[model samples]
Target: MKKLSLLLPIAAIPVLVFADNKQMTTVTYLDRGNLQLVATEEPSSFARQITENTPNQDRRHTLENYINSLLKANAIYNHKEGKENPRLIYQIHANNEGTIIATRSEQGKYGVQIGNRSLPVYGINYDLQSDCSWQEQLCWVFYPSSNHQKERWLEISYAPHAIAELKEGVSLLIRNLQK
Candidate 1:
């Protein structure tokens, strides 16, 4: 009877291990910038964020909405809106230590989840006017100006091809986030 009980518990170990792996997600970390993301397996095209959020590079409402979403998310943790540092959207709780994950909805927007809240995720657009290598053009860079700022990440998928100058901007950002 003792042997059977020990064997039963051992058998359950493999099952539990496999279950945990199945629930694991794909997270990429960008070290230099100190950012991590479980990027949306299905990120919508940059054209979508531009057209859907605003018409023809209006930049007014689109920027405002994006700002509002950040403010909303930041407010949750910091308990202050607008004035507070906006990075709270992607920041994990001190207790939970959860992962930063970006998920795209059928509606084609990325809502990055941090702790218990989901904030709209946006990126800057790299215009590959001629040779567009990848489907995802919105290269979400951590340091836009290479200068330190409160709002580090921005979804600029509609402006220009400046970010395209950097090799694999998206991959670089993700890899550095881990460190």
Candidate 2:
């Protein structure tokens, strides 16, 4: 009974955060080392198709390598903070059925219908839970948690599209890199 009490709340985290809402959007850790969206209800065939269209590990590695190359670049990174690493960390998910689903969004942030469902999105944007921004175009932004040790990524919705955002931001970083 004692151990059971301690284990209950930990197990209930996802349920408490997700079940309260009628819409169920689930993300799981894919075997390929990425996060994949799992439909809480019956997955739409379109969503399944979108999932099928996602890039394989080999291609994904190539993209990651390219992104890594850009990190040292001038305009794209924020080097003022003294921490030189600013890399693209993606949490890919599909926008199945085109319905706006709030996976873990709270009340204030954006990124509802704007998320990159066409492919894996860069990040998400919920209200105060915002770990991302449109203007800054930073995803996987580490927001410190209670312990100040662990952090959560802010989800931001970028304009045009996730891909365009990447290209534009990279260019902006390069163009502004000299500044």
Candidate 3:
């Protein structure tokens, strides 16, 4: 009985260690006014691999490559778009710890407004949440639209960890509208 008891405890240690390591990883990315969230057993590894594989080409191509790499890494979904410049827009990258936000917008037109400032029409918005606090970031891409193209503008808002807030915010917004 004494020998059995010692062996049982030793055998259980691996189980405990494995249980601790079984953590879920989730990654969120936004592109062309769309949002994609990916969950996996090894998120950091997947993200790093994808980012590394992307080519350091021109800014526009690089951005597209990055977004494409992320899409290949996991499932992707469309979020929303601003009414104006639909093509000119932004992308968002967010994890549980921090968020990286980037924006690409047309210049010399009606400016895009985030929070209160008049950002370029094409910009990226991000909301990051942690255990103790939350942060928001934005990036702007300034380029002029061609005269041949219709002067359309688009704004995108992305929050990987803000699903709960988004649901509540939408509900409240709609509720207030009904009133």
Candidate 4:
């Protein structure tokens, strides 16, 4: 019994880690009017764990709804209605750490804005050092300046691209809320 108890914990370690992986979900939202999109990329294993371990379907649904609501409330999904035609939006791909992998724009109006926008906008790119960095391994969000050929806004630690956009959009939306 004593030996069995010691082995049990060791055996449980992999299970615990696997359980943790299952709770991750990837979500993506697009705002055509604002030309913005937010996406969360969770490992497949993690997402499966979350779905399987959720107590009930209602709880799972609620969680998904909440995430969707957050995306829309933050203007990540083009809150404006009745617009005849909106531009394609940028995409926000996030990993488990909430770090955005990339911000890709479809070839269209959205692509043009991404290329032409003069103001500072949130973006993700790789950090290259003396050591070679693989594309998949490098991910970050920073403000890219238009005036300078090689200028970057202060780069902070990894954060979800959607959350970052939501933070900025929420303030703007609040001002318009009363109106």
- lDDT, model 3, position 154: 19
Poorly placed runs, candidate 4 (over 4 Å): 1-85, 102-165, 168-179
For model 2, the superposed segments whose C-alpha errors exceed 4 Å read 1-57, 69-140, 143-148, 151-179
Residue 107, model 4, lDDT? 34
Per-structure clash totals for the candidates: 21, 12, 10, 6
List the candidates' TM-scores in order: 0.21, 0.19, 0.23, 0.20
Expressed as tens digits, the lDDT of each residue in 1-179 for candidate 2 is 35553432221123212554555655454444454455466333322232255455333333333333332232233345443433222332223232222123222234222233221222322111223455666543233234444353323333333333334332222222222
Shift in Å, residue 140, candidate 2 = 5.5
How well does candidate 3 match the true structure in TM-score terms? 0.23
1 or 2: which has the higher lDDT?
2
What are the runs in model 1 whose C-alpha is more than 4 Å off? Answer: 1-41, 45-53, 76-141, 146-179
The sequence of per-residue lDDT tens digits that candidate 1 reaches over residues 1-179 is 35553322121111111233454334555556565444333334343444355543353334334433432332322223334343233222111122223322111125433334232123422221122224543333343222334232433332234333222323322222322
Global local distance difference test of model 1: 0.32
Q: Which lDDT tens digits does candidate 3 get at residues 13-112?
A: 1111123577655555555546655555633333234335654333324433445333222222232443434333434332222222333333324664
lDDT of 4 at 59: 37
Top TM-score model: 3
Best by lDDT: 2
Q: CA shift at 149, candidate 4, in angstroms?
A: 11
Distance (Å) between predicted and true CA of 45, model 1?
7.6
User: Whose lDDT is higher: candidate 2's or candidate 4's?
Assistant: 2
